[model samples]
Target: MLCALIGSACAGARDEGGTDEADGQGDEFGGSQECEPDPRGTEPEVALPSPHEQLYELELDTWGISNAGGDPVETRTRMNEALAWALDNGFEGVRIPAGTYRVGEKTSDIYTAGIELPGSMDLILDPGATLEMAPNDTWNYCVVAVRGLEDVRIAGGRIVGDRDEHSYGGADDEGHGVCVEGASKRVLIEDIELTKLTGDGVLIVGQSEAGSCEDITIRNSELHENRRQGVSIVGGIRVLIEGNEIHHIHGTAPQFGVDIESLSFTSKDIMIRDNSFHDNQAGDFVNTDGTNVWFQGNTLDQGDVTDQVDGPIVFWKRTDQTIRDNVVIMHSPTVNGLWGVIGYTNDDEPRANPVPNYIEDNVFEGGGIHLARNHGNAVIRANQIDGWMILGSRLSCLRLSDNAVNKAEGESYKFREVQGVASGNLLNGAPVALPMSDDAPFTNSPPHLW
Candidate 1:
C-alpha cells in the first residue's frame, strides 16, 4: 500500500529481524506463540517491545479475581480492583498468572465488562491465563477496555468474547474482544490472541475531546473467527497493524479483516502492512473515510473456504490512499472477482479531491482494479492484473501507465467515459492504447457491482 491527505504520514521505528510466525499446527487462527522481537512487515517496520521494570506478580487469591468467576457482576468488580491495585500501589507493571476469570457487570442501562487499565502501565497475562467476557444481553461489551488512557501496553494471554452464549434476539450486538477508545495515545497491544466476538476482535474508536487515538500499535497478534471485523479503526492516528493473521471474518455485513471507516476525517496515517489475510468473508480490507491510509505488502487470499462478497479491497471516494506491493489471490472469478483486486466508488455526485489515489506495484493473481464513479484523481501504475482493468468511472484525472493486463475472460469492454490519459500499457504483451476509446478500451458500467 502507498503510504493520506492530512498532517504527516508517520512511520514506526523498528529494530531488526522478522517476528515469529504462527505455528499453524492445530486450530484455524493459531496460537499466541510469543512473536519474536520486531514484527515482520513486507516493508520491514519493527515494533519496539514494551519494557518491563518493577513488575509485580499478582496472586489470584490476593487479588480475589478468580474467586467470583461463577458470578458475572462480582467478577467484574473483582477484576476492576485487581487491575487497579498495582497502579494504586506505585507499580508500573503487573502480571496475571493462569486462570479463567469471567467478568461483566450491568448497572442501569450501561453494561461494562473486562478490566479497564490506567495510564503508564504494563499488563501481562501468563500463557495459560484467559480473561473471558461473561454472557450478557447488552448490545455493547468489551473483554478489555482501554479508555482514554495513555502509555499502556497489553501483551500475551488470550481475551475471549461471549459469542457462543450471547443472546442474538436483540437488535444491536457489538461485543468486542478489546476496545481502545477515547483520545488514548501511545498504546501497544501485541502478541495476543483475540477471537470469537459478536462485534470485532479489536475496536479502536475515538470518542474523546481530541476525536482520535494517537500512536497506537496492534502487531504480531492473531485476530480470528470474529463475527464482524478483525480490527475496526473508527478513529486513530499514526496507527500500525502489522505481522498478524486476521482471518475468518463472517456472520455479518461488511465483514472485513480491517475496517478503517472513521467518522469525518478522524483517521489518518494508518498502515495495514505485512499481514496474512485469508478466508475473510466479505473482503480483506475497506477504507471508507480514512486519509493517508497505506494498505501495502499484505497477502490477501480468498481460497475455497468462502466466496468473497466485496472482493479483496474496496475504498470509498478518498484520493489520498496508496495501495501498493500487495499479493492478492482470487481463487476463481466469482461474483466480485471480475473486478477484484481493488474497487473505488462514491454514492453522491461529483466532488473535488486534491490528492490522487495511487495503485501501484501490485501483483493481482486473478483480479484487477475497478473504479465506479465520482470526480477524483487516480494513478494506476506498474501492476500485473489478470482480470478487468475497467476504468469507465467519472474522474478528475486518471493516469494509467506501465501496467500489464491479461484478461481472465475472452470479452473486454470499451472505455468511453474517462477523463485522463493512459500510456505505456500492455494488453496481453502487446502495446495497447489506454483509455481505449469507446470501441478500443475495456470499462465497467455504472453502479451495482455484482
Candidate 2:
C-alpha cells in the first residue's frame, strides 16, 4: 500500500495537499502488475520504486526538515521550497499542506499561487486548501505549469482566479489555470475546480519541441466561467476525458465548452463520455479532427437560438469511430457535416480515407438539423431524429437505410438514383423521388415506428 503509506504519514497537513500513490497496486486503467514495455520498443525508461515509493521517502524527510508556520500564505512558498529541496537532495515525494494561501505580491494585491511548483515532480494538494491566482497579472497567468515532465499528478484541491481580472487573455492574451507542455506524459488531473481563466482553462497543450502529448486523464472536475473553453485537448494519444461538467465557458476566441482539436499531429483513442456540456455560444459542445474516438452516454444541451452553434458533436477527418447513445437536445443540428463522422486525407496525396464510422442509438429533438453530408461511408441507424432538415434533398451519397425520418423541417433527397431504401420513414413532404428504394433496406413507417 504505497499510496496508503504516503496518505497516512501526510495526514498531518489536513489543510495542505499531499500526493497519494496507492501502494504499487494497479488502478482501473493499469496497475503495477500490468506494467509492460512499449510495443514500439521506444518505451521511456520506467523509473523504479514507482513514483509512490519515492514519495514515501520524501515525506519522512519533510516531517521536521522545514516549516511554514508564520503565515498561512507562506504554506505555498513552503510547499514549493520543500519539493525543491527534496528534488535538490534526491528526495522524490513532495507534499503541500492545506490552507488559504494568497498568490502574487501583497503590494499588488493580485491573486496568485502562494507557492509555485516548478516543472517535473510528484506534487499533491490537500482537499481543504485553495490556490488563488493574481488578478492584475493576466500576462503572468496559470497557477501551475507542468512543462516537460513525466509521471505527474495534481489531485484534489481548488484553483481559483480573480474574477475582476477575468480578462487575463481578454482578446488574444494566452493565460490558463494549468497548462501542461507536450513533453509530459502519464499525467492525471482529477477532482479539481478551475474557474475564471482569461485565456484557456486547464489546457493540455503540445509544444513543437515535443512530438506529441500522450496518456492523459482529466476526470471528476468542474470547469466553468472562463473567457475561453472550459477544457481544451490537443495533440495527444490515448486520452480519456470523462466525468466533467463544462459550462458557461464563453469568450471571443471561438469558445467551446469542451473542444477537442488538433493543432499539428493527430490524437488517437480519445474517449469522451459521461459528461454534461451546455450553454456554449461560439461552437457546439465537442469539436475534433480525424481520430479514433468514442463519444458515448453524454448529454449536450444548446439553449434557444437561431443557429444553435454547429453540431452537438462535429467530427472532421475522422475514421473508425463510434458516436453512440448520446442525448443531444436544443435548437440546431443533432449532427451536421458531409459525414457525421468525416474522413479526411491531408496533404495532396491524402493519407487515410474516411470509412467505417458508426452513429447509432442517439436522440435528436427540437430545432435541430440531423444530416450527414459527406465522407467515405457512414452508418446512421436507430437514431430518434426530429426537427429541421437543413441539408438539401440529397444529404449523403455514401449510404442511408432503415431510418425513421419524421416531421423534417426542410427538404430530403435520395442517392442520385443510386438505390438506397427510404420506406420506413414519416416524411413531412414524402421527399424527392429516388431512382430506386428496393436496393436498400427499409422497415417500420415513420408515424407507426418512431
Candidate 3:
C-alpha cells in the first residue's frame, strides 16, 4: 500500500539513490574486497545465487536495533544499530521484516560491497513492509544505494519516504528513488515498489567513463509520481528493464518519464519490454541517448500530459535503437506539439552518424511516428499503425516496406507495407549503422509492459 503523501513536492525530496557525477573519492582502498570472484565470464553477469544460498539469514531485528526486540517504535537508533551490526558481521545482506522502520538521516555506504572495486550484495524485503527515511532539509539522497557494487541484488518490499511537515515540498531537487551507477555490473532490482520520491523513480545512470551497467533486471515493481526521470539510465550495456508499472510521472523540474542517454557515455545493448507507462506529463515514456537499445512488448497510455515535452517514446540523435512489438495508445485529442514518434539528428559521420532506424511489428492505436532527427535510417515495416500521424521528412532514402497503416494522417505512413524504407538504424544517424542488432538475436520477446 502507498503511504501518506508526506508532503507535496515542497518537502525536500529524497536524494539520488545512485552516486552523483563526482561524489566518492578517487579511491577507497581503506576497505578490503570481501566478495568472491564471478565465474560467469569477466564481462559481468547479473546472476542470482541458488535459492538456498540466496538467503542471508540475517534479520534486522537480531542486530540489537532499537525496535528489534519487539514491536518497538521507529527511531534512528534502531536503523544505525542494525546497519552497523550488519557491516561488522560477515553477513552480505540485511533483511527487513514486515514492519514500518524509520530512519532520520542518511547512513554510510551500506549497499555497495567494494569501495574502490566492484562486487555484489543482497537486500531482501519481506512482504507488506515499509522502510521510511526522514526527509532531509539539507541535501537529497537515496533510501538505499548499490553504488560501486557489482553482482548487487535489491529486491522485494516497498521503500517509503517520510516527508510530513519537515519534508520539503518541491523546494529541493535532485532527489531520487534508487540509483545504480556506472561500472556497477550484473545488478538486479526486482519485485519492489518505489513511491513518493521527489526525484526520478529509479536511475541506472552513467558517469564520465565508458563503463557499462549490464545485466540489470527490474521486474514486477511500481514507480509513480517521481520529480525527475522515472527510470533514467546512461552509458549502459546489455541491460534488461522489464515488467514494471510506471505512471503519474509529474515533477517540479523538467523531468522525462524515463531516459536512456549515451552522450559521451556510450549506452548500448539495452532491452526494455513488458511494462506499462501511463499518465505522464513530461516527455516520452522511453527516451534514449546516442546508443543502441531495443523497446518491445510494452503498453503506453498517455494521460493528463499538460507540458510541452515531446514523445511517448523519444530517441535522441545517433542512437541505433529499435521500437517494435508494442502497443501505444494516446488520447491527446487536439494536436499538442509534434504528436508521435519524433527523431532529430543532423551532421554526418565521425562523432555523430545520421542513420535511419529499423521499426517493425508494432501496433500504434493512435498518435503517429516521426523521424525526429535528420540523420540515421527509418525502417518502418510490418507494423499496424491505425490513426497514425507522421512528423518528419520524406523517406526517399528510407527503407519503407511491409507495413500496415489503418488511417495515416500524413504521407510518411504510405510505406507501412512496402519494403526498403529503413532497416538497421545506427548511432551518429548513419544509414548503415546496425548498432543494436546483436550478433545473436533475442529468442524470446520480453514480458508485457506492466
Candidate 4:
C-alpha cells in the first residue's frame, strides 16, 4: 500500500523529458490505468514542497519539557525556556510531541501568554499534541503569541481554551488562543484546532506604525465554540484565509467566523475562499471592512437554531470587492430579521458608498442581496436567490441582471429611490418587471417563505 501511494504521487509529477505518457500501472484487466497526457505541448510546472512538510523527530522531552497533563507550571516554564534556547542555538524548528502540555494556571493574569515564538522558526506539533489552557477569569492573554516575526509557521495541534471557566465582563476581558501581532510577515498557520476560547481563535493584527502584518495565510483549521470570532484580522496585507471550518461562535455581539476590519490602519489584498461558517451569532458571518477583498467559494449557513444572524457577508466602506460563487443556507426560522447574502453599510456609521464591487454567481438558499444606502458602479448578476433583492435609496449606476428569485415575499425586487437597470431576471417563474419605486420604510423583514 505504501509503495502504491508513493508510485501514485510520483506519477503525478511532470515528466522532464517532454514525454506524453503517464508513469503508472495497469488496471485489473491489465489495461493501462495511467492518466491522459496534457495535450498543451508544454511541460507542467512542478511545485516545490513546503518546508513545513519536513518531519521533526526531536521531541520536547529532549528539552526537559514534561507532558504530564496536570499543573502546567513546570511544562510551561520549560517550553518557554526551550523556545528561547532554540532561537539562540539556531534551531530551524521545534517539535512538540503527541501529548497534552498544560500551559497556564487559573490564577495567572490575563496578560500571560503560554509561548512566544521568535522570528524565522517553525513550531511543529504532532497530531495529538494539545496545549490546554488552565481555567481562568482574565481575558487579556493568549495561548501562543507571535509578534515582530518573519517566516513563522505553527501547524498541526489543538489549542484548548478555558472558556468554561472564563467569564465575560466586557471588551477589556477578552482573551485569544493565538495572537499574531506587530510586523509579522510570511506566517502560515495551518491544520490546527482551536476550541472553547474566550475570544478569537486566531487574532492577526498590526501594531507598529511603520509596518503591517503581511503575507499571512491561515488554512485547513477548525475553530468552534469560541466566545468571539474564529479569526479576527485587525490589520494585515495580502492575507489569504482558505479552507477553514468555523462554527458555533457565540457569547459576543460580533461573533463572526472571520472579521476583517481596520483598526488605526487599513488592510489590503485580503482573500477568503473555500471556508465553512455555520451557526455563528454575529450580524455578518464573514464581515469585512477592507480594500481589494475577495470572498469566493465559501459556505455560510445558519443552522436550525434560535440564534439571529444579521447576514452572511457584510461590507462597510469597502472598495474593489468581489463576492462570487458562494452558498449561503439560512435555516433559522426563528431569526429576528431576515438578511440577504450580502449587506452593505453599517447602521451607526455614516453611509459610505462602495464602488466597483461585484456580487456574481452566488447561491442564496433562503436569502438575497441587500444594497443599503448609496452604491456606485456595482454589478449584481447571475445569482440564485430565494428571498428579496433590496436596493436602498440613492444607489447609482448599478446593473442587476440575469438573477433568479423563487418564492420571494412582498416584492421580488424592492427598489427605493434608486436609478438602476434590472433586466433578464425571473421572479417566481416569471420575467420580473422593473422594480417599483416604493416608499416603504427600509426594514429587514423575516423570511416569509418559512
Best by lDDT: 1
Each prediction's Cα RMSD?
A: 12.7, 15.6, 14.3, 17.2
Question: What TM-score against the true fold does each predicted structure earn?
Answer: 0.82, 0.68, 0.70, 0.80
Better of 2 and 3 by TM-score: 3
Reference-based lDDT, residue 13, model 1: 9
Ranking by TM-score: 1, 4, 3, 2
Residue 21 local lDDT, model 2: 29
- Give a tens-digit lDDT track for model 4, residues 1-450: 111211122222111122211111111111112212111111111111136433344455476776767567677777877777776776777888888887874445546557777657888888989988776557577788898877888889899887887655555325788888986888888899998888889988888565678888888999998877788877888888889998888875467788776566667778888998888875334444566678889998887445554456766544457788989887653232455444444322323333456788998886667664433346788988886444443344456789888873665665533444668888877897775222212222222211
- Tell me which residue pairs clash in candidate 4: 139-174
The C-alpha stretches of model 3 lying farther than 4 A from their native spots are 1-84, 106-119, 162-171, 207-210, 262-264, 288-290, 306-308, 333-338, 346-351, 394-396, 408-450
lDDT agreement with native, every candidate: 0.69, 0.51, 0.52, 0.65
Candidate 1 lDDT by residue in tens digits, 32-112: 122111211232232333565877788767755663356767777766776677778878878878877788876535465
Listed per model in order, the count of residue pairs whose N, CA or C atoms clash below 3 Å is 7, 27, 66, 1
Question: What lDDT, from 0 to 1, does candidate 2 have?
Answer: 0.51
